[model samples]
Target: MNTILIIANLLVLFTFIIHTFGGDKNLKAIEPEQDSPKRLRIFWTMSRGAFHIVSIDFLFATIGLALINFTDYFQESKLLLNLLALYFLGYGIAFLLTLIISKKFSNIYFKMWQWLLMLVIAGLIYWGNS
Candidate 1:
């Protein structure tokens, strides 16, 4: 289980790094060029900030998980473990709620993908507790 977590965290960290650098292209592709220069600039700036924040947040999460798995630090903290599980559960619930209530995204496949991801997170939490 530790090995699985280490590998998953590493992969997520790598993906976050990639998005931090490459996300601008995807954002630009989605945004229209005909928009006003001011609006475009503001959008791009906000997008870049969001990307950076996401990358840093993932980096911290990855490091925290790695430490919990591989080091003596926080290894025996039951409270921390419970908090992590709660975080996972809360995130899963958020995904499910969003998928259920949001009609803005009509893609069933995407909804299914989110549901599966939520299940995986819940499973990981359960495994950790067990």
Candidate 2:
């Protein structure tokens, strides 16, 4: 078994759990007031959808990585593995770029540190495949 991929799978699963349950409260906190403008309400609805969309992505990644590590189902699917690696790499890069562009460099490593996890998972997937 690829131990590194297994670790990556576990991390993805953990992230899914946290991003789902733990994030729900934060999601609720963003709800627009009933008296808010129509555009604000619509934006809130779209934002909520986008938040759950990410949860779904994490769920799928967890299942995909689990299958790849625990079974022979994807033994011949190098392209799939590479694609997953690239997906996480893009996630990490986008996250870092957002932080940079936002000019939030003070204590950047600890604040909104999900990018670190993303990069670590990407690295593990690539290294395991290699």
- Judged by TM-score, which candidate is best? 2
Off by over 4 Å in 2: 103-105
TM-score of every candidate relative to the true structure: 0.64, 0.91
Instruction: Estimate candidate 2's RMSD in Å.
Output: 1.6
Best lDDT among the predictions, by candidate number: 2
Candidate 2, residues 78-115, lDDT tens digits: the string is 77788999999999999888887886667986788999
Q: After superposing candidate 1 on the true structure, give the runs of residues whose Cα lies further than 4 Å from its correct spot.
A: 7-11, 14-24, 32-44, 104-106, 109-115
> Residues 1-130, candidate 1, lDDT per residue (tens digit)?
4655555456556656665667667676766456668877787778778767866765776676677767878856456555655665665676677677866656764745644554565466446655
Consecutive 10-residue window with the lowest summed lDDT within model 1: 114-123
